[model samples]
Target: SATLRIELSRPSSSEFTFDERVNRSHCSVSVTNMSQQSLAALVIAYSILKRRRKSEQKRSCWVKPWIMQQSEFSACSMLAKELRIEDPLQFRNFVRMSSQQLQLMVELLGPIIGKKDTKFRTAISVHDRVMVTLRFLASGDSYNSLQYLFRIPTCTIGSKGTIVQKYEVFPDTREEWQRHAEAFNVQWNFPHCLGALDGKHIVIQAPANGGSHYFNYKGTHSIVLLGVANANYQFTYIDVRCNGRVSDGGVFQNCSLYDLLENGSASLPDHEPLPGRNMPVPHFFVADDAFAIRSYILKPYPFRDQPAPNRIFNYKLSRARRIVENAFGIMANKFRVLRKPINLSADITANIVLAVCALHNFLLSTRDSRENYLTPGVADSEHPETHEIIPGNWREDSTSGNSFFSLERGKRDNYTTSQRDVREEFKEYFMTPSGEVAWQYRHIV
Candidate 1:
């Protein structure tokens, strides 16, 4: 039998019913040969019915009631809490500027940090959050206390957390910190200085074993050392190896900075060569009598008689040296760890120190004006003067040596007793500037 193929035409309404009945047999045989118009009409009808069913299902599954209920829930409510913004514009402005500064640091350290994970992909930029966290730490509030202020997680506040690790991109090297200081210097005003130097202790939970070494004379355990700060009080150098038993002088001597100074390799910023001199030896740091005297390291002059000019020079130097002391004070007050005893691993303690110093610099650099974070009952005006004997010049007696100070003997005993004698001698020398102020001497005693 042959497969028959036929065509059928159907018209609208009553005409289609009559045609279908009349051609029922033919229509059954020719269904496969229907016209393109008939096929198109069938597809259109199916699509319309599908859309209607989908619309009805969507209407039945509406979530407006649940959404409204959620909105009414106290936890889901959005409340705009009023906050005191010192300068809403200031932080944004600083972010724009600081981002450029941070980029420069990345460029200079490109070879080292470029290959490592940058880790800056959070909603808050890593650098901005780090800077903010540091400011909070330096300002000296408890970690739990800063939740409302910074809107950061409590876990992110300390050195061991995600926030700090993400931001600690640079290596803990003197050169690296120096580069950071250079960047900070560009943004802040600190003349004749690369960075400020101070020491701080980071408190920790007591170690389970061999923890006695961390204990210090203050009846607490700590790691004592020196930190280099920019004029804005940011750390450019941090040495945290010295045991808490060591003095600042001991820490400096053990640090690579002392070796750099001794070998004449350390470079000072903006230092000009002496007139008619081939290479300018960098100017040394300003320290109390704790450090050795080199042409580079400047210390206050020991008290001497008859010269008001020298005394004036010493006074100015002492005033300048106070920047470091004030820097240390600020560090201690801002991070209660320094005020309290530290009890952590030496490495962690060191990291805490660096982190705190970095934060101090950040706060000092960002703040409109720098002020000491003084303790209660401690007046800003009451900072005591630190007296240092000019090393290599303290003489036991005028007749015994051409110079008054004995550097050789002082070095042996760690300069402990000798420091006392030098202070006394300076007091005596100052009392008799052309004439005796006997009553003033009484006041000093």
Candidate 2:
């Protein structure tokens, strides 16, 4: 073998050695022989190649806009499109600000905005984004789904954390909601009407803690209550915190509206008729039979002999009242979240419901114009005009009575039936053949 020399270098006090040898070029290299020098060269080359590959991988981490996949950009674009709101600040410039209306609302909701120092904060934290987030929640889109539509960061918009705290700080009380009713009436061509009241089921997830409390006879977990919508289909009142077990009538009885009417706490401003009605006006609202009929709460007349006129009035009222139903339908349809089972806490769920109603009103108000479903047209003489009214003379049996009737008796004193009689009459009216009623009114104009 050729003469061989090995030099061991250990900088620290250790038995392990790193060998070094003098190469043909007189350069010091770690090796055992010529073959070892060849191996060392290959190891250095491999190390350099590995380092370059890692650098390339790091560069590839950031995708270029052009080379970026469509799926990635689509997610962001779709969200931006949905959340895009017409410049409200720009809208403020052209639309005259109604100071009186704002003042009225402020007064009604004032108590809820109790003395909280944090209300005046200038920073735009997640708390400050409540209104926008409420709009998203009301719309019922996933957080990622809404990310591109609204300017709000996706991170802040959907989190349950403090999302509703702002609303608690700026609650819209019953009175404040009612103030919008007049504006809605004027816009929708309804006269002397505050709002249309009706009930709906807000389905919720069966609570882990309160399963029996939310269970309803309908075989689902739901909170049943009423909502009052103005002529333009804006919510003036949303009474949703009731237990799922309560009846519509029971819920209405305990509602703030009932309290206001019963206690005379609700002040009716002297009805000044618009230029058309020469006399002082009266304020009134449309309600279904679930509520007690009052001067303010107009109900359909019970069935009577030749109940045509009462039927006509009921038909008109129904035509007007359909707005609330349509409003609820649109809300549930657009914000698919409302259609699905809500799994949030009761308080947050209530706020979410109200916020959705408010957003519905806002969108309706801001649209180019609302389509009027009820065009002024006369009923065909050949086609007998059908009217469903509360019936008279069926007052003796109140309980277990027919639900349908003609309310021909205009006077309030005439509405008398024992609770039993009322129920019996309701059953009879409910069982009455629609064909028979149509045949009876077939000739009446």
Candidate 3:
């Protein structure tokens, strides 16, 4: 009986003081002195009038008179260079893309997000939606600011913009991943390094009475974005939907990719002999010590050992795994939304992250990126350890990661013999003359 009783809490204080605000009239309606049919008709007509009045009031609140005055400086006429954006620096500062990049995005997103008008409501033009969404991504401006600046309905700009963002962020081809592995082999001389793996926390405002379901150790609420990126700074595979409290390893264990890796369904590369060696090592993703050693995954040795082999191994692995860090930096710097906490639901935030990942890959593919526009939080030259990992953006996650995949194995040895075998073999190889890089020794020793 006590549990069944409802409890009401005091409302939180608001920025606008309620003392001088308009008070709503509390009254009842009555109709009399008419036949039953006539009275019912009169009531229905009054109801319709009330509904219309409420709708008009809501419309007036969002749609301002200033929009009409600013029609001359609309998105296309002012932003697209119709009025001529004389300063290239100014253009990049506002929209976060060059004129050429904007045109390319318009072409790419047009077919996917375009729609037709129905009898009920007019359809928004694809141009307006694309440009505004890009502007939001680049500048991290509030939805209200975008609505007023672009002179479009806030609801349309936000809703349709999210629709464009829902497209899957995974690569169109598996070849893209293979290309990344090849690049690591040729450029970094880190053979069999298929990709760099890592996880980032996408911060969001905690839901009411959320407790700790969204809380992370960083004292913030977030959803984990676990991604595998290649040497070209393109995301090859990503798991966008996971609880924030999940660790880098916890997210990895829960995803279907882990099962694929376990069952050999991932179609990984063959075991080719090490250069000038008789033994063959299978292709694998390089992650940090946050991840456990696995047959198809590698990590640096713990800080305890003082062996030269371990030092060299850590150096080589660090060089390879650092790619994912740089990739995340480039993405957050370019798409400012990731730089700050997203004041949206976890589901919507996931979509925004995925869409930006897809867009980042698209941009990386189309251009050389000699002059990428990067902000401070996420820059190309940023070192992962020195940076705060997107500070002032972590949210509180209440969910515990106890039920995540790794726990299913039970608490026996925490690791299997095969896991140890994999790490040992890789360690020995990096110490060998064929696998050793000259700069590695200077840094490690």
Candidate 4:
């Protein structure tokens, strides 16, 4: 074996190799019998490698030339501008909002998302930021795809959750609740109803170290989006990003809305008599069997073999509850971002869901866009002449598949006397002339 010696030394520029100085190994082999020619070749090789590393560290350009031409070539600059002038329908299809609506959004969110320019470069405009965000919401395209289409950096575009305020769509006072109640009574024949309550699973990527917290009965990772919608299919209140493992009843019980209602700070209207009836009933939301039988929550009577009165009650309750379902369906069908598994982090996914919910309400707010946004037969409709249920276009597409799924019904628990009494009152009212509809019997059969 050749004898080896280790020598520790501080680096001298021409003496030690780059690895030894950077790695701080501080030791070099000194083979006394090695040829001088071999040592000279090794030093030359190290010098070449060091030179190559420095060249590789240099950036090719500050910004790509194509990115610099975004003002002229970007989708927002070209397609959006052209559509804003020539075709409004096509513009809504592209950005998921009318041009006027887009501008309004910029005005509303400008202060929050706007950035100030630095000496090095100009900040992205608030209008451009909103446009990019809307495109992300409409298409659910990856950030890389958005970067090239919008000519914005991938890091700059994403859905922000800062806009999910309930006061924008939800009722805040007894007067507001009364208005919603009137709408439900007129539209769905459900008296003293505030809105429809429901929940759907929003699939998301498994989070790091999440274990089974985000896992659901469907064998996928998800979060729940529980919402309350008025009769017109607009969301009034939404509790987003509840753990998928929890039942809808559990999620509702633990949410802030429930806390407020329990504390009597939710501004719920006092119990009032049903239309044309002497008995007063609590104002409540209609949901499916997945929820509890609370005084404020009216779920349909379980089991299909119910008596005639019970079946009629279920039919009417389902008709009212359909608003929330159709709200989810129309959203998933239009936005399409909700149709597939979201690959973002849990926090970002929550923000995206909330953003779309806000966008849904915003789309409904505009008189010009509202009619076209929810056109005739786009959502489930009742035949004017025959009263038959005509499935919406969304229902046809939903059959293909989507991330939207219902929660499993929770185990039956003994309901309080008051809860049981509320359901019975509604059941009895459906048989009365005031609550009964000419077509309800035909539809129930």
Candidate 5:
């Protein structure tokens, strides 16, 4: 029972073996018993076997010379070129600027965006930094979404904390307002029109402990961007990153743009006579029913009764005011980011809003080659081009401002005597020969 027996009737010898045969329960082996050449052969064979196995099956890894060598900028350029994205429109749709414009942009903003020196540490190229920032702003796409396309840690580049800086983007100046007024007068025939004012709710995640603070009447969490856009759909005055719950009127009342207007620092053009009349009309910001009617900010009369004059007022105001809608529509269409909710903090949201607005102004300044594709007509609730203010029969009152002061005055609860007078003046002005449109009577319901 003490003897251990193993039965192998016919044993076979295998290659590359260091063999030992057990003789008893307590067995001992001596190195002197084995031949030196045999031991050397075993060692060599074992080593060869290990190397062969390693050669046959090795650990998988991903690495390539080209991938390792190319930087982010080089890679992006190579990709854009390889895809044949040469056309301006194609480039605009992809990265929101033409190739030339992109180069000029890199020249302008490069040094300021941390591309100053790479002698001390490895730094990202200016082109790479700007392209990433632009792509983020134009598409409203997230850093995670762009990784596969750009092969970069996009969230880390050109941003302090997921925010493109506001100082980099330029807003409309006093001269810009003059230019905007000229454009509105020339194109839409609405003289002294500074820009169309509107607000859009940029949806966002429920802020930390932000219960209803961000909840809007639209039944969504958002930050409102109140933009005053010129006829070319460029933002002249931007009141960005307001609470989503605030009304258009509320935003206007509280914004710095409005403050400038109130404090007389906006340097707006003085009240000027209408094109066909001597009564000077003050430059005003066009808005919808969401805003209160003011001497400087004109809104359409309440859409209740069917007076010929009131209908004309609605039609005319709608004609000019719808530009805001068109501007917002074009912006949302171009930057699909506006169409989706942005998931970021308030500070970051404000910075992003500023950047997008600036990009809008840049594109407008550059002027897109394809006219109809990017320039949408004024948006109307009823139709794209709803009001036809060319000509019609409502020209009964020919004398300008005649009997305009004596019209029936029904006002909103908040309207003061002077505010009502301004609205009435505009209404009668439309009924007068100077303000009347030939199609006013024809379009009336």
Candidate 6:
């Protein structure tokens, strides 16, 4: 009788045979007919060959040659370095921010947008990512254009919620609301005013099979950016993604902000009398005729058949509402993305608008950027002594094909009697010594 067993170990195979019938003899056999060390060497040689083939294949397909040289030849690397070292003004124009401001933003956003480097390749720097996004916004160029310029693949920038929430803050406290009101009173001579509200139509490509949901009266597809701007031209409250077909009043009625204001939960200050007036008035937002008049909101009297006092009130409201218009103007001027029909999806376009609004506030936070970004005559300015209006550069392009269009006026009958009374009170106040500005009469005339 014979028993056979086979064992394989360390790339070598051995067979053992035992015979018990005659003398219990034992014998050993080698399965490969080669020395154990030789078999082990052959196995090791085969593994090395296979690994080499895989390594060569990976090297051939890993990344494009131009992409690999991004550190040295990329537009972001070359142009940004030269502009930063040579001409800071051009650098500001290039990135829509100063070097210092860009560095500060990078530091703020680094930890959140930062990526861990892997063994195969290094992660993209946060600064580069920001620069790419800003360039896209500043030029309104397509992702393909940006990829060629920045030497990066086409991708959307992320982590915008932090910046949007931090900078574009609504006035939620009494003090904050009073701060805006005080600014309006001092600058625009409108008291008890929290902000200037309006809607801007941002053109976009027609959605696939969307029909008339995004179609506007202008024969284009658009989404509305409803914003309330403070006296200093910073957005305090913004509602985006509203359908263009809806009237401004309809959009306002549908927004959560309208509910907040109507329910007295928007954290507005208590009703207070105008300066030198006895009537207690609620703090309200000033809007255009496109918006419906409410107890907490005010619009101008009709354009036709207005008396002197009503005209004066309308002029004053127009002056205050100019801030919101200027806010949109300056933003569109600086970030040209809004100037053209954004070709991205509606969701991405909304995110882009929110991001630009946040950056608009961020750039205004510092004195240098504020002054440089919105230099004299860049935005509508009031003469300190004469109180004359100096039209901004944005006005030069008001009729340009790229600029935004005004919202269609809503139904005039939508206002209530009490809302009309509020307007009348303002009309009466504007003609009085308390709320009247000396130049208001000149403008009205």
CA lDDT of every candidate: 0.44, 0.47, 0.66, 0.80, 0.61, 0.79
lDDT string for model 6 (23-81, tens) is: 22223333455666766766675566556444534233566777767778887789999
Ranking by lDDT: 4, 6, 3, 5, 2, 1
What is the C-alpha local distance difference test score of candidate 3? 0.66
| Residue pairs of candidate 4 with colliding backbone atoms | none
Q: Candidate 4 — which residues are off by over 4 angstroms?
A: 1-60, 158-167, 399-402
Model 6 CA RMSD to the hidden true structure, in angstroms:
11.2
Each candidate: how many clashes? Answer: 13, 50, 17, 0, 4, 0
The residue pairs found clashing in candidate 5 are 391-438, 391-439, 392-438, 392-439
Name the better of 4 and 6 by TM-score. 4
Report the candidate with higher TM-score, 1 versus 6: 6
Better of 2 and 3 by TM-score: 3
Candidate 5: residue 41 lDDT (0-100): 58
RMSD of 1: 19.8
Top of the candidates by TM-score = 4
Summing lDDT over every window of 10 consecutive residues in candidate 5, give the lowest-scoring window: 400-409
Q: TM-score for every candidate vs. truth? A: 0.45, 0.49, 0.74, 0.85, 0.69, 0.83
Clashes of 5: 4
- Better by TM-score, candidate 4 or 2: 4
Model 2 worst lDDT window (10 residues) = 372-381
Per-residue lDDT for 100-144 in model 5, tens only? Answer: 767877776755775454553355567777777777766666777
* Candidate 2 wrongly placed segments (more than 4 Å): 1-191, 269-282, 303-306, 367-445
Candidate 2 lDDT over 277-337, as tens digits, reads 2334445677666566665665666654535544544544555576676556555644445
